[model samples]
Target: MRNLQGRLELCSINTATLGHREPLNQTIERIARAGFGGIAPWRREVEGGDVPRLARQIKALGLSVTGYCRSTYLPAATSAEFSANVEANRAALRDAAVLGAQCFVLVVGGLVPGSRDLEGARSQVVDGISMLLETARECGVPLALEPLHPMYAAKRAVVNTIAQALSICETVDPDRSGFIGIAVDVYHCWWDPELTASIATTGQANRILAYHVCDWLHETNDMLLDRGMMGDGVIDLPAVRSCVERAGYNGLVEVEIFSAQNWWQREPDEVLAICAERLQTVC
Candidate 1:
């Protein structure tokens, strides 16, 4: 809705896109130089030292925060493991707050080893989210439930649909007080038959937290990496963004790629330039 003319003020860069080529701070500076609206960083980049200082750096560079990289890896065999994840998430949330992030993205973990309890894994997800919501609310930062692709269901996320994530949002924070929502990453949802409907539903409920961009490669080299660039792949991004727009989301379209082979090997500035160009022409 913000860019009805196809002018992209919503373009952002996830630092992982250039993770292999540069350090986090340099990536942030490069992203700012490339003219993206925001950056979403992984937790490791901020954990070692002064997060507020890094926050100041990001702010001074005139870039905004889309969300923090990740939080939820809750599924564990032992109660101690679950509690440890909760504490880790809480600490991640605090870092997000310090970075002045709008939301903290949650990549709910997969099943415990040797376990076939999909339902139990989901239960752990729900419980973990419920526990974290209060801290998220207190910090005035939202918790973004990223429904990873079904390909990741075995070891990444139990909630693999926009419908499922929204259901959690309703159950945990029904008011949609902007405290709970979904991160709609196009790479994960473009293949879904129910995606458009889900986006519309998310819009009506105001549960769309952050929108991420990346192309899904056709060859499918690796399950965890091997993402495609915007125009290089088959995704109709503008159409997807339109669905997100229709769903009442006016957030940054954060470009997140885990391409171990392609984008990561390129120079950081070159990658940013391509991301910007692709955003304008194709996205």
Candidate 2:
């Protein structure tokens, strides 16, 4: 595994870690001054400011767009809703292109509203991705499908495993043209029994697009907002990083935490400093 002792250049922070309490422009400046190499800003954060100016500012500050946070959920109750969601994704992809992002992340949403058929929802996900590949390919932005934890299987994401995300890729980008891939997040995937082998397989296919770090707390109060920092929870983060590196993913290792009660309630700079410190020492 690679030693990241002083390599802040290899680290990135998903702006959501700052709790979205501030505008992205200021957030960008603080993150750059904090010595991170990249920032993954969410769509809402980007929309609050001018993309053209934001793009210029980020470039001037010398930060890579690790990724555009996500695609709108692909599954919906009706054909029209699904089509609208696709158009929204196309627009998001265009914005991602404007930022020169490394990839456009996809959360491949859960079962459609008012439905319980998991297989049907997965179909919508595959078809939605197939349709969006045109825009993604045109923009030259790879789509990084992110599988949420199984608990999110009903409301956030139906694709709950790396294997499932890879299966979607097989159906959509069979040629491996680099247009489709998976975004691995420890919070969502640490429970998978086949993660190490899946990471190896993802490397063999060159489909691992992003690696996210956050710990899963054992006694979580809220599943969506209770993620822990590195070394604060039960996850074996260093071991996971080794597997990811061995699988050939040498890109930025992003920190994405959603701690509503703890970190989010603290000062942003302190969070960023802790993130940098943890990435270097623990992660």
Best by lDDT: 2
Query: Estimated TM-score per prediction?
Result: 0.96, 0.98
Q: Worst 10-residue stretch by lDDT in candidate 2?
A: 45-54
Residue-wise C-alpha lDDT for candidate 1, range 2-94, written one tens digit per residue: 552344456788888886455677878888877777999998777887788889999998888999989859999999999999999998998
Model 2 TM: 0.98
- Count residue pairs with overlapping backbones in model 2: 0
For model 2, how does the per-residue alpha-carbon lDDT over 1-283 read when each residue is reduced to its tens digit? 8888899989999999999999899999999999999999999988646898999999999999999998899898889999999999999999999998999999988887789899999999999999999889999999999988899999989999999889889888889989999999999999899999988998889999999998888888898999999878899999999999999999999999999999999999999999999999889
Q: Evaluate all candidate structures by whole-model CA lDDT and list the values in order.
A: 0.87, 0.92
lDDT of 1 at 201: 91
Candidate with best TM-score: 2
